[model samples]
Target: MFPTLHIAEKTTGSRGSLALLRWALVVIFLWFGCMKFTSYEAMGIAPLMQNSPIMSWIPAVFGVQGASYFIGTAELVTAAALIIGTFNKMASAFGATMSCLVYAVTLTFFLSTPGVAEPTAGGFPAISAGTGQFLLKDLVLLAASACLLLASIRPADA
Candidate 1:
């Protein structure tokens, strides 16, 4: 055991970490959401979205440009709600819920999209190092979003 660590001190540190995590999430959502509005970003994700059963129809209904704008709007709104959470826990809780739902869909891309794994190295389940890595990073964001969800729901308890 570390003699230097104390319960109160640890709690303070944990709280600080959570605050930073929440703020980081807010920034990422806003930034990425803004990127979705650009043609480069839209096209970059189009292939993955097209292959996804859960997302394929998006293009049909909204078209690529429209879909990208919609995604950007959603992200902007989510970020706004999270910002509001700084004062209103209810708003933050709603934002966290939205974030959880979005992250869940992105996680599903591992199964829905092709070329996500390395074919030459091991093929199929092996997963391409780059794509696999990109998808893998979502787990941390998912966890952070979930933590925010719990915090929003429990408020005082969290």
Candidate 2:
């Protein structure tokens, strides 16, 4: 029904868009993963990790800074697999799976961490700009990662 839709689609077809999505995810993982090594970033995430039932064990076992390092290492590995995925579908599937898991865990911060709702704004659906909004973005990332995983598993002709 839209006149320019075909032109826009042709400009960046499905494959092209998928490639862009893949690269964008790569950048996010690489950048944030690297940032995990810094004391500032480590401390910034500590409260979230501390409150999470799923993540609290990390700090207990490795200590705060050590837990950050461990997470950073995992992210770098995911990035490497994604880079290699450009050449290998199996690698792509693996990387996408990792991406899904990472984002899923991050999304849980919305439930576990305090102050997700801005109490002054009447709370509940009224999300806080800081932690709540920051974490909400992972919903998109998880969906994107799922798409990549499905594409990796699909037949070549499909």
Candidate 3:
């Protein structure tokens, strides 16, 4: 009876760990998504977007506030899906795609500029100096999202 209980306890612990991982991922998405709304200006991201060729068309079509709202909505929705574990795969894939796009845009900025210095304060360094670092960070995020997507597809028993 003691041995049997030990095995059962071990199994439960494993399941608990998996559940914890899922919740941790959800919280991560939520926190990051919320940051987009709260910290854009402080991070100097507003100006970067205003100057970005990749996003230039956004303001022309929707105006700055409208464009910000659109992007913010996307982030918020993805975060919601992650938190609720609804459409997890789709949310994760969308998140991964967004990260990739950000990486590309930042990389472009980094390459086009010269002699930019890394920011000592918060927020990303100016693209010219921080493109490589920015891309590296986003790639890591993309990998995490991809892993979550794969995990969502796996059978619970597996």
Best-first order by lDDT = 2, 1, 3
Query: Which pairs clash in model 1?
Result: 117-127, 117-128, 118-127, 118-128
Candidate 3 per-residue C-alpha lDDT over 1-158 given as tens digits, one digit per residue, 9 for 90 to 100: 36443444333245355456456655655665565555453244555566567876776687666666666666666666665554455554555445445445655554443334455544345433444454446545555554555556556676
The alpha-carbon deviation from the true structure for residue 38 of candidate 1, after best TM-score superposition, in angstroms, is: 0.6
In model 1, the runs with Cα more than 4 Å from the true position are 1-13, 155-158
Better of 1 and 2 by lDDT: 2
lDDT of 3: 0.53
Backbone clashes in model 3: 0
Candidate 1 lowest-lDDT run of ten: 6-15
TM for every model, in the order presented, reads 0.87, 0.91, 0.53
Kindly list the per-residue Cα lDDT of model 2 for residues 1-158, writing each as its tens digit: 76563444332238777898899999999999999999998999899999999999999999899999999999999999999999999999999999999999999999999989989999989999998899998999998898888888888876
- Candidate with maximal TM-score: 2
